[model samples]
Target: MDKDLNSIVQKALLGDKKALESVVEEVKDLIYNLSLKMLLFPEDAQDATQEILVRIITHLSTFQGKSTFKTWVYKVATNYLLTEKSKKDRKAKEVSFDEYANQIDTGQSAMIRYTNNEGEIGLLEEEVKVSCTHGLLHCLNPANRLIYVLGDVLDLNSKEAAEILEITPSSFRKQLSRSRERIKNFLTAKCGLVNPNNSCRCKRKIDFLIDSKMIDPHALRFANHTKRSIDMMQKIEFLDKTLSVFRSVPIIGAPNGIMKEVRQTINSITF
Candidate 1:
């Protein structure tokens, strides 16, 4: 933790109610996004974020200052997500890039309703990008999925990622490299976002997505409303379009009302 945040933690520990709430607010987005990516559904992510916050509150005093507070929070988070992963049946069907493309291609004639609202359309486009990229992450197993998210999407360094995962830097790097190559190769081969030669694009698939009920314009949940459209298309070199596509999607923000709900939950707890 930085000295300022460390001071906040000291105040929080001293039974300052506002300071404790500040601690929850400080890490809220980090925990929420981590759960969002790990769980792959907004409702599940919200639940996980609340649960993780409660765990943090329960164990806050045990934080020994051995690692930055952010790192420790992530450690608590990853452990919770891992345990959640283990409780489920491990076999999530892997959708190949080709399979995903074909699904869109075969469903094109299903009568997608075009909206006159440009903003809604743009939000839909962004929704597809984020959902697809997050789906790609899900194609990896839980461990590699978390590793790739930490090292690549979140841009944590090797030491920081290893600390969150409780692994040596070498091990984290190894998993991240393999995960990256696997995703890159998959996207390059089948995703039109990377290879212009391929026959899929977000605009072209909007019809199929609507027909399939994969996107609802009024209920768009993943599009980042705060940023401008131009900011969404991150520029990578033409040759590195796969990475560019991954980079282009904006970070999904927490839903409205979650922060207040979290604060209330934390305050209600005896701990």
Candidate 2:
């Protein structure tokens, strides 16, 4: 946290209504993006973001200044995501590496009769790549998924991520390493983006995904963004080149109108 946000937090704690709203504005993107990665759905991410923001406001006084406010916010968000009952209730069915590989392999013979324009094809391919990689994260249990998202995608250092996760830095590093290796192995074996010889190209999957209604050509979820997650990340030394495929995933903004909803919800609360 910077001096401005720290000062805002102080004012918010003193019953400054504008400062409270400022706090929400400042942290909403972090909370929202983390929720999206954890939940793998925009609607669920939005709902969880709202709930987490409310929790932060309700517990603002509990912040002891032991860590940066950003880290503290991460602690609150991760705790809710880890323990929330509805997360399990709403989670998509888990797919194993074998099952996913089979799914990709099953549709390889299909022809791309939909579009021939190179630009449109590229967009659809991007959608497939982003959607497929996000789905891959579900193969890991929630804990490991969170570990990967925090350590690799968000590029948080081991000590900070460990503090956020309430684990020792060594344990965090161990789990993150395992998660990275698992994802890297799977991608290298199956994804053309990571391995040129792999048969599972994003362009190859575009037709099947569209035909099956897994992707909407008009309403793309991940491909429309101008900035990828990699643009915001600092390069990790000795990272496997294969994992760069994940870093290519687009960084999506929180859904529109979320701040309005948050403001309304804040108004309803006494504090």
Please give each candidate's TM-score. Answer: 0.86, 0.89
Badly placed stretches (over 4 Å) of model 2 are 85-88, 109-111, 226-239
Poorest stretch of ten by lDDT in candidate 2: 229-238
Identify the runs in model 1 with alpha carbons over 4 angstroms from their true place. Answer: 85-98, 104-113, 224-231, 235-239, 269-271
Q: What is candidate 1's lDDT per residue for 1-271, written digit by digit as tens?
A: 5777888988877777788888887887889898877777777787778878888877888898999999999999999888964475244445665666566466443223676577776676677767767677777878888998888778899999999998999999998999989888887776666777866566666777777787776676577543532244545444566666665555556666677766776677663
lDDT of 2 by residue, 1-271 (tens): 5789999999998888899999998898888888877777777888888888889988999999999999999999999988983445466566788888888786664457779897787777777777787888888888999999999988899999999999999999999999888888888888775677887767778777888898999988777763443332235333565667666555566676778877886687676
Q: Candidate 2, residue 223: CA error in Å?
A: 2.0
**RMSD, one per candidate, in order:** 3.1, 2.8
Query: Scored by Cα lDDT, where does model 1 land?
Result: 0.74
C-alpha local distance difference test of each model: 0.74, 0.80
Best by lDDT: 2
Per model, state how many residue pairs clash: 1, 0
Clashes in model 1: which pairs?
1-68
